[model samples]
Target: MRFDKYNKKTRAETEKEMIGCLIVITCALVYLGYETEWGTIRL
Candidate 1:
């Protein structure tokens, strides 16, 4: 009983994409966190 009639994406595929996005976001967040910390110390 899928309500999404127009989109045909499967659950596994969606989860994989979501995980990939999360990985990228996490990496960016970590990098930014470290950069800000280092920048504040260097100031």
Candidate 2:
């Protein structure tokens, strides 16, 4: 499926988008992990 925002993207551009998404997700997870006080763990 096309990303609605973009009519077309090259394979290289698509791969770059995927990599960028993963990096953003990984950083967010790490930040949350640090922000959490694991003492008895409460969400």
Candidate 3:
């Protein structure tokens, strides 16, 4: 029973980390897109 509780907690933490990573990746892509667009306009 204690092992089951520990497993559940670990899964929750892993999910949170995955979500955080996805958000960071999305933001990075958006920033890169804007930078590329501006670079083209400037050129």
Quick one: ranking by TM-score, best first? Answer: 2, 1, 3
Indicate the residue-level lDDT of 19 in model 3.
100
**TM match of model 2 to true structure:** 0.59
| Tens-place lDDT digits, model 2, residues 1-43 | 7666775877789889999999998787776664446543222
TM-score against truth, every candidate: 0.56, 0.59, 0.55
Better of 2 and 3 by lDDT: 2
By TM-score, who's the top model here?
A: 2
Tens digit per residue, CA lDDT, model 1, 1-43: 4639726888888788889999998787776664554463221
Candidate order, lDDT descending: 2, 1, 3
In candidate 3, position 43 carries an lDDT of 15
Per-model tally of clashing residue pairs: 0, 0, 0
lDDT of each: 0.69, 0.72, 0.67
